[model samples]
Target: MRSMTRRNRLMAAIKYLVCAIMILVIAVPLYISVMGGLKSVGQLRAEPVSLPNPVNWNQYTDMLTGKNGSFWPKLVNSVVIGLGTVGVILIIGTFAGYALARIKFKLNGLIYAYFQLGLLFPLAVAILPLYLQLRSFHLLDSAIGVILPQAAFGLAMMLMLLRGFIKAIPLELEEAAAIDGYSRFGFLFRIVVPLSTPILATVSVLTLVSSWNNFFTPLLVFNSEKKYTLPMGVMNFMGEHAADWNLILAYLTLAMIPAVIIYVLCQKYIVAGLTGGAIKG
Candidate 1:
């Protein structure tokens, strides 16, 4: 009994130590970015790790207030692209998920497998083909260019998550609705969708973060500075503000806030969605 107790205590200590290490790994970078942004360029150079003596708010406020038409426009572009990608993925993924999970049909397994194949491949491999397709369609340098490819790449994961979640729904509920004369669409919208809120939130948060932080795709697609998304804009900003570490950190910090806010708010749903979606469809 004493040996077992000692072993459990050792295991618990190890787990706590691991958790603390992970927290430090994540928190240290965020602390540097925030505090670095609050310092002046000279102060950042001199006392890189020390807290700001006289906090400099201008780096953030100046950009937000349109001092140079840099940060806000890029933020807006990110919002538009992120929302557009989410909209397309949700509309298409939900129906596809429902059909794959609930409706019995020929080639359903094949079709589902086709989407699953997408998960096996990374988008980088197909960038050349995707870029050519976009160019052919005259979609280059447009939000549509970014949105379509992002949605296509993201669809597979979203569908899988939603399908697993939908399959977990009680079939008796669908039959009960059918007995009440509910149409398929009605049952889906009223019943399945409402019940799949956690998964939906999961997909939304994931899509938003992916779209918001997307750099390579936007860099390849958007040729014009005016249409540059936040990630692209931040890169360009970094180039211009290369000498000013504080300003660069400020841009990076602001660019990260929205996605961070979203994840923080939907963290509970993320956990639930991931766990629930792990069940086989």
Candidate 2:
């Protein structure tokens, strides 16, 4: 009995240690970024690790007020693209997911396999071809250009997640609805979607984060200053002659806030959605 008790205690201690290490790993960088953002360029250079000797709000002030550049417009552009991409993903992915989950068709498995294959194709591999296609359509510097590719890349994952969730929902519900005279579209929008809110929220949050943090796609497609996304615009803070580390960190700090807010707000749904479909389907 004593041995078993000792072993359990030791395991608990180890778990606590692991948790503490994980927290430190995550928190340290975030702390550094926030504190670094509050420091001036000189303070950052002089005392890299120390707390700002005199807190400098200029980094944030300059960015927000557009003294350095039009940070607000860049932020607005990011919001537009990110939200637009999520809207497209949700509308299209929900229906596609419902079909994959419930509707039977020839070679449906093969079609799904192709969608899954997209996950394997790294973004780098398709960048060149995607650039050519976008240029041909005159979409190279447009928000629509960014939105379409982001939605396309996200659809596979969204469909995969939502399909599993939708499948987990009992088919009897749909049958009952059908007997009550609910049309196909009606059943989907009215019944399936309501039940799948958890997963929908999850997918929405994930899509928002992915679209917001998209640097490479925006970099390749959007060259105009007016159309710059947050991630791409952060690069502009770095000058060729000298990079402003404090300002760059401030931009990064600001960039991360919206994603964090969305995640925290919807994390409960994300968890429920992920687990609700695992084996129930």
Candidate 3:
């Protein structure tokens, strides 16, 4: 009994140590970025970890006030792209997921396996071909250019998550709705939708975050500075203010705020959604 108790204590200590390490790993950089942004360029370099001597707020204000900056435009672009990607994913993914999970068909598994293959090939592998296709479609420098590809790539994962959750939904509900004069589409939109909210929220949050952080895809698709997304705005800071570490850090902190806010607000839903998808379906 003493040996078992000792082993449990050791394991608990190890777990706590790992958790503390992970928190530091994430929190330290965030701390540096926030503090660094409030310091002057020289102060940032000289006293990297020290609090700001005079607390320079110009870097952030300059970004927000658009003092020769494109922060607002870049932020708006990210919002548009993120929302659009999520919308497309949810719309198409729901139908596709429902069909795959609920319908009986011979080619269903084969079609699903084809989508599963997408998981093996990351987007970078098809960049050149994707560029060519976008150019041919005259979608270059357009939000749709970024939105469509992101949605398409995201569809696979969305389908996977949604399929399990949708399958877990009781079929008897559909029969009851059918007797009440609910059409198939009506039943899906009305009944299934409410029940599947958790998984859908999960897919939305994931796709939105992915679309917001996608730098390369937007870079490849958009050539115009006006159409540039937030990630691109980060690169601009690195280039234009290369020597000004404080300015760059300010930009990083500001750019990260929205996504951070989103994650914080929806984190509970994310956990619930993922759990529901995994265990129920």
C-alpha RMSD of candidate 3: 2.8
204-271 in candidate 1: lDDT tens per residue? 98888889888878988999999999988888988887788888888889888987897788788666
lDDT tens per residue, model 3, 1-281? 99999999999999999999999999999999999989998897799988999999898899899994688999999999999999988998999999999898999999999987877789999899999999999999999999999999887778888888788898999989999999989999999889988788888988888899999899999988889999998897689878888888988999999989998999987676567545653
Instruction: Judging by TM-score, tell me the better candidate of 2 and 3.
Output: 3
* Clash statistics: count for each candidate: 0, 0, 0
Report how far residue 182 has shifted in candidate 1, in Å: 2.0
Q: How accurate is candidate 1 locally (lDDT)?
A: 0.89
> Clashing residue pairs in candidate 1, if any?
none
Please give the RMSD to the true structure for each candidate, in Å. 2.7, 2.9, 2.8
Off by over 4 Å in 3: 1-21, 271-281
Scored by TM-score, the top model is 3
Give lDDT: candidate 2, residue 113: 89
Candidate with the larger TM-score of 1 and 2? 1
Estimate TM-scores for all models: 0.89, 0.87, 0.90
Runs off by more than 4 Å, candidate 2: 1-18, 269-281
Candidate 2's residue-wise lDDT over 48-161, tens digit each? Answer: 778887998988888778877667898899999989998999998898888889999997788888888777888889999999999999999999999999999887778778
- Reference-based lDDT, each prediction: 0.89, 0.84, 0.89
Residue 151 miss distance in model 3 (angstroms): 0.6
